[model samples]
Target: MNPFELLGVGRDADEREIRRAYTAKLRHTRPDDDPEGFQRLHEAYQRLLQIRRHQANQQPPVTMAAPVAPPAEPRPASTPTSVIRAEPVFVPQRLDIDAFCSEAFGRAATGDNRMLSEWLQEQPAFWSFRAKADIGQQLVRRLYRDEPAMPTKCLHVLLNFFDLDHVHAGHDALALQRLSRRSQLAWELMPEHRQALAARMNMQRRPLERCLARLQRPYTWWRALAAGFTPNSAKVMPQFIRELAGPFIEDLPPSVSQEQIRFWTSVGHKNPVSGSQLLFMAGVLSMLSLVVMLGAAATTVFSSQTDMPRLALLGIGVAWACGLLWVALRYYFVLDEWLSRDEDEPARWPRLRLATVPLLLVIGLIPCLLLPLSRGMGFTFLLPALWLSLRRYWRRHDHEGFYVSPGIARIGLLIAIVALPISPSWVFAVATLLAWGDDLRRHRKVLQLAG
Candidate 1:
C-alpha cells in the first residue's frame, strides 16, 4: 500500500500532519473490531516515517549566493548603536511521547545505538531523575497496551536510558530505586526471555527444553556412536528447571539478584533449543532389549529342532520386543484423551484395556513352555505372592500428565490384567491378605523389640 494514500496525506506532508491523519484513522478503526485495518494503518504510519527520513537524508543542501550588502538597512546600524540586548527565551521541552514511540519502535531501524542514545538524552525527563521515572512509566504502560510491538530495541533503550537494571542506595534521588523495583518484575518478561536468562546464568533450563532434548537424543547419540565415540555424555543439571526458575522470575524466595534478571532480559534471544530425557531413556532400553535377544539366539543353538524354527522364533522375539518398545514410545508422546488431563487430576486408562497384560503373558508363557506341568502351575500361581512382597517398593511418583517412566504403572496394570485370564478374585484376595500379614508381623516385631 502506498502509505501516502493510506494516510490520506500528500507526499510533502510533515511528520505531524501524517501523525494527525493516523490519529484520526486510529479512532475510527478499533483494533478489536477491525484488526486488519488497524494493522494496515500502523504499517503505513511506520513506512511513511521511514520514507520521510530517507527523503530528508537524500535531499541536497540548499546553497545560495551571498545576499547583496543592501539587504541590511541603514536604520539597523542606528538601532545597533543603542546597544540593544536580546534576552534568551525559555522554550519549554515538551516530550511528544507518541512521536518517541513511533520513531523508536517503528518496524524499520531508526539509527545506530549512538544516534538513539542522543535522541533519548534530548528528552527533558532524561535530565530529571524523577521525571525520567514518570515518563518511562508512561512509555512502559503504552508498550504493554500495545504488546504486539516487540521489545527488540525498545527494551534495550529503556534499560540504558532509565538505568532500570540497578540502583545505588547512596544516591540522593529516590526515583532510581523505583525503576530498579520495576525492573525486577516478571509480568513484562516473556518465555523466550526467561529461557535465555537461564542459559546465560548456567542455571537449570526449562523442563520443556529438557523434554525436547530427550526426544531428539537418539539421532544425535546414534550419530556419535557411529563415529566411534561415547554415546552417553553426562551433564549435572537440575532434574526440573521450571521449579527453580519460577521463583527467580517472580522474585519469590529471593532467588537471585535483581541485576541478573535485568541484564539477561536485555540480551536478545537468538539461541533456540532444549533437552528431552524421556525419549533418550527409551532408546537406551530398546538397545538393551536387542542385546537380550542376541543372548537368547545363542542359547537356541543346542536345540534338536531345525534351524528354520529357531530362526523364526528369533525373528518373532525381535518383533515382539520391538512392539513393546513401540508401545512405550507411543504412550510417551501420543497419549489418548484420557491421559491428557492436568496434573491435579491426571488422566487414567479404562479397566479392561489390559495395561501390563503383554508383559505378564510374555513372562508366564516362558515357564509354561519350558518347565514341567506341576512346577509351572505352582510358579504361575506364585506370581501374585511375589507381586505382594513389593509393598515396601510401591513408591509414589509425580504423574506429570505424560510418561516419565513405566515401572510402577506397568505393575498396577499387571494386577488389573490378572482379573481376566488369571485367578479372577483369588489373586487380589491373596495379595491383600499377604500385605496385611506383613504389616501385622512388623507391628508385633516392633512391640517385642520395645518391650
Candidate 2:
C-alpha cells in the first residue's frame, strides 16, 4: 500500500496533516508501544519516500537480462485455495443503573396502567402485586411458577383500597414512586438470572413488611393529629409497641404504659424533642420568660422615656417573652400531653400556641424598636432574644423530610445577617427568623450528633 494511503492522508498533505495522522495511528499501532508494528509502518514510509526521491533525481535507466528457467520436477497436484472472510467487530453496549432507572421512570410517567401492571406482573412471584390477594397469587403462579418475595409496597397500596389501615400507603406513595425509578437501574446492573433473583428477593417482602410494620405501627400524637380524631385506644398496633417499649422501659415515666412508651418512642423518632432534654428545654424557657418580663416592666416603668433605647429594650423584652412562652408550651404542655394522653389533641395546641406568641409579640415590638434608644442595651437584648426565638422556631419545624429546603435557609440567613446589624427596623431579623429558622432546625436534626 502507498505510505500516504496507509496513513490515510492526502499526498499533498502538509506536515501538520502527516503529524496528525501519525498521532492518530500511533494510538492504535504503537511501534514504540508495539515494536514490530512500529517498524513495519516506519519501513513502509521510508521505502516509499526513498523511491520517490530516487525517481525525482532521474538518472539513466539500467537494464538486466532475464534469467533462464530452471528444469521443473514432476508437478505436484494443485491444491484448492480456501478463502475466509473477516467478520465485523462487535462493540458491546454499556448500561448504567441510573440510565435504566430514568428509562423506567419515563415509562411510568406515560400513565398507562395496563402496561405498568403487565410489566410488574412479569416480575418474580414474590415481587409481584395484584388488585386482590386471590388474583395476585394466581398471577404470581402464572408469572413465576412459584412463590417469591412479594412487592409489599404494591400490596399496601392495593390493600388500602380495601379499607385496611395500611399507614405507609398515604406517606410512602411518593417515596415508592421514586424507589421504582431506581429499579430499572438495578435491573441493568445484573444478568438475566440475577434479575430473576432480585424479583425473588422482592417476592419475600413479607419479612421486610413485618419488620417495618413492627417498627412503624406505633402512633405519635402528630401522626394521630394528622390522622384526624383522637385515638380511642392506647393500644398501638401490637407489632410496633412490642419493639419500641422494650429498650426504654426503665427510662419511661410512671404514668406511661407499654402502649404509651411505644407511642412516645414513635414521637421521638419522628420529632427532635425527646428524653430528658425536652424537659430541660421547657424549664429554661419558663425561667427566661419570667426574667425577661421582670426586666421589661422594670425598664418601662422606671427608665427615662426615649425612643431608640426604650424601643430596643422593649423589642428585646418582648422577643425573650415569646421564646420563653414557646419553650414552655412545647415542652411543659404540648409534649407532656402527647406523652401522657392516649391521643394528640392536647399536644398539638401547645405547638400552635408557641408558634403564634413570637409572631404576635414581634409585630407589637417592631415599631418600638425602630425608635431611638437612650442606650444600645436594648439592641443587645433584642438581638439575643430575636436569635433564640428564631433559632427555636427554625429547629421546631425544619427537618430532612420536612418541607423546608436548604436554599431558603441560606437566603434568609444572608438577609438577616446583613440587615439586623445596620437596619434600625426589626424587619430583617423577623424575616430571617420566619423564613430560615425552621429550615436550619430541620438541617440540624438531620446532621446533629446524638446527645
Candidate 3:
C-alpha cells in the first residue's frame, strides 16, 4: 500500500500526525509480534516525514504576467514607416598552424624568444604536451636552443608542430617511443592519442602491441572494465582482452558482448531485498522447525520400551520438508518480482549465477551433506557455513544496504556455536528467533526515510 493510505493520513499530513499514527499502529503491531505489519507502518511514517520535509523546503511558485492589454495607439496607414538597420560587426578569421607558427617565430627572432614565449604562454594547446620531453625537445631545439634558458611556452609550441597525417617516416615512430618513455600521461590516454594519430595517418593501430612497453606499470582492472566493457562502448572484446593482458603470453578467452558484461557487473549492485533480513528470517524458521522435529525424535529414541510409529514419523518429516520448500519458493518468487520491476529483459540467469550458486554451496549443500551422519555433525558443519556467510555479507555491505550488521550476524553465529554443544536443537532455534527480532527492528528504522 502507498504510505499515505497505510498511515490513514492525507498527503498534507504534518509530522506530528504521522508520529501519532505510527505510535498507535505500533501498539498492536510490535516487531516481535507482527514484523510485516510493523514494517509497513514504519515505512509509512518515514515516507510521510520525507514528503513533509520536501514540501517545506520547496519554494512557492511565482506567478508571471497576467493577460496582456491591447496596444493604446493605432498607427495611421498614411504615415510612412522608417526601418532601423543594425550595423555589421567585423570578426577575424581563424589562423592556420603555418601562419600562427610563422608569427611566433618572427616574434622570437625579434626579441630573443621572449615575445614567442609570452604568446605561447597564452595558448592552451601548448600545456597539453608539458610532460612529453621528446615532442617538446623537437620544438625546443628548432625555436630557442641558442637561448640560455628556454621558456615553458617554447616547449608547448614545439609539440603543436607535428601533423599526425605527416607521421609516415621512421623518425615519427622513434619520437613517439622516446616521448612515451618517461611520460606521466594515463595509460588509456596515451593509447588513445596513439590511436588518433594512427587513424589520421591512415595506418592500422594495434593498442595491445603499441601500448605495453613496460611490464612494471600498474594496471587498474575496474578502470579498464569501465572504459572497455560498458553497455554502449564500441570497443571490441577480443582487442580489450588482449590489452588487459599487457605483455603476458597467456591464452585469453574470446570476449563476451557488452550487454553480457554490463549484466554481470550490474548483478553485484542489485538488492531487491535486504539479504541479511531474508537470511535471518529463514534461519529462524529453519531452527525452530529443526528443534521441534529433534525434540520428538529424541523422545522416541529415549523411550526404548515403546515402539515408535515409523509411518507417522515419516509423514512428519515429509510435512517439515514441504514447509521448508514452500518458504524457499515463496522467497524466490518475491525476489524475482522485485528485481523484474524495472528491467525490460532482466537477464535473471546472470544474477542467479552470481548470487545463488555460492549461497547454495555454503547454506544448503554443506549442512545437508552432514545431516545423514549425525545431528551433532550437521550442527558442527553449520559453524563454518555461517562464518562464510558472514564473510560474504561483510564483503557485500558496501554495495548492498545491510538490514542487520555483520557484527550482529557474527554474534548470532557465536551464540549458535556455543549453544550447539549443550543443546543442538535449541542452538539454531534460539539464534534464528533473535536474528529475526534484530532484523525487524533494524528494518523498521531503515524504512523510516523511504517514500
Candidate 4:
C-alpha cells in the first residue's frame, strides 16, 4: 500500500505535515477503539519514515557507457608477402597486489568507495571481473590473490569497507545479503577474520559508540553513557544518527553538542504543557494552594471563638489569589515559548487561552467576596467555578495532550468541595496529594529519558 495515500499526505510532505496527519488520524482511531485501523495507521507512519530516510541517503545517479567493439577492416591483399610485417609488442606488467590492497584499504578507511571503484575500473584485469562478481567478492579476491600471508589489519579493513559501502548505498537489502555471504567466506578462510567481523558488526549495532568514535574531541565516559539514554535514542540513534554525524571520520565537526543532546532527551518526546517538568510544577502549585486552604479551615475549626478572624482570612485569601495569578502567568509564558518552537500548527486562540487563566483566577476569588455571608456559603461558591474552569481548560488544550494535570486537579477540587462541611483540612490534604502524585509520575519519565 502507498503510505502517502494511507496517511492522506503528499509524498513530498514535510515532517510537520506527516506528524500532524498521524495525530489527527490517531484521535479517531485509537488502538482500543479500532485496533485494525490503528494498526494500519501505525504501519503507514513507519513506512513513510523509512522512505524518507532512504531518500535522504541515496546518492546522485552515476552514468556508465557500454564498451563498444571497434569495426573490422578488410585484410590487405596478399601484397604483404613481399613487404616485412610489423608485429605488435606485448609487455607483461607485474601486478603488485600488496600495494593495490594497501591503497584500497586507505580509500575504504576514508568511508568513500567511489575512489576504490574508479581505481578498480582503471585496471584491465579487474575491470573484466567487475560485472562477473559483486564488489565485495572482487575486493576480497584481489586482497588475497597472491599474498600467502594477509595481515590481520588488511582483513579487518576489507570487512569494514564492505559494510560501509552497503550503508552508504542506501541500505539495499539484497546488496547487503550478498556482501555478508562473501565476507563470511573470507572469515572462514582465516579464523582471525571472524573476530574482526564480529567487532565491526557490534560497532554498527551500537550507534552511540560509533558517534563518539567520530567525534574530533574525545568525550568523557559518563557523557557517552548519558547519550545512550536520550529520548528516542533506541529508535533513532542506531540507524539514523550517522546521517547527522558529519562526513569524514577525522576532522569531523561536532554535529551534536552535549547541551543539545540533553535538551532533546528531556523534551523531545513531550508536548509543551504536558512535559514532565511542567506537570510537576502544576502539581506543586495545586498542592500548595490546597495546603493553605486546609490550614485556614483548621484554624477556624479549632478556635474557641464562634466567629473566625475575618481580617486574617481575607489576607490569606488575597495571598492565595496572587500566588495563583503568578503561577498562571509563569505557565502561560513557558508554554508559549515551547509551543512556538515545537508546534507546527499556527498559533490559534493562545491569547484567548492566556486571558481565560486570569478570568478563572478572578472567578476563584468570588468565594472571598461571599465570605461575609457564611463559611459554608463561601466554600460553596468555589465548587461550580472550579468545575467550569477545569472543563474549559480541558476542552481548549486537550488536543495538545495537556489534559491530564487539569483532569487530576479538577478531581481534587471536587473532593475538597464535597468534604468542606465535614473536615476541610483532611479532605483537601488527600486531594492535593493525589494531584502531586500525578505530576510526580510524569516527572519521573522525563528524568529517565534525560539519563
- Among these predictions, the greatest TM-score belongs to 1
- Name every residue pair that clashes in candidate 3: 46-448, 284-432
The TM-scores, one per candidate, come to 0.31, 0.19, 0.19, 0.23
Decide which is better by lDDT, 1 or 2: 1
Better TM-score candidate (2, 4): 4
For residue 264, give model 1's deviation from the true position in Å: 24
Error of 4 at 44 (Å): 59
Q: Give the runs in model 2 whose Cα sits over 4 Å from its true position.
A: 1-345, 348-357, 360-364, 367-406, 424-428, 435-451
- Which structure among the candidates has the greatest lDDT? 4
Question: Per-residue lDDT for 442 in model 2?
Answer: 44
Cα lDDT tens digits for candidate 2, 1-451:
5667777877666544554565456447753367766655555444444444555678542222344658955655795555542232212233343443344334444434455444433322211112233443333233222112223333333333223324532436544433333332233222333334335445343443433333334535444333212121223333333442344344322223444444434544424445323333334444555556566667767877545455555766775577567555555444333332212234455434444434544554555566674325445444544554555444444443335466775776777787767764455356535544553354454335421
Write the number of the candidate with greater TM-score, choosing between 1 and 2.
Answer: 1
Residue 181 lDDT, candidate 3, scale 0-100 = 23
Task: Give the TM-score (vs. native) of candidate 1.
Answer: 0.31
lDDT of each: 0.46, 0.43, 0.45, 0.47
Residue 189, candidate 2: C-alpha displacement in angstroms? 78
TM-score of 3: 0.19
Model 2 whole-model lDDT (C-alpha atoms): 0.43
Q: Which stretches of candidate 1 lie over 4 Å from their true place?
A: 1-99, 102-116, 123-133, 142-157, 163-313, 322-385, 390-435, 440-451
Candidate 2 lDDT at 4 equals 73
240, model 2: CA deviation in Å?
A: 35
* Candidate 3 lDDT tens digits, 66-172: 54758858789998888542222212233354455456555533323455644554443432223222444444344332221222233333444432223542346
Could you list the CA RMSD of all candidates, in the order they appear?
19.3, 29.0, 35.8, 27.4
lDDT per residue for candidate 4 within 5-57, as digits (tens), equals 88899968865567667755755676667867766777777666666666677
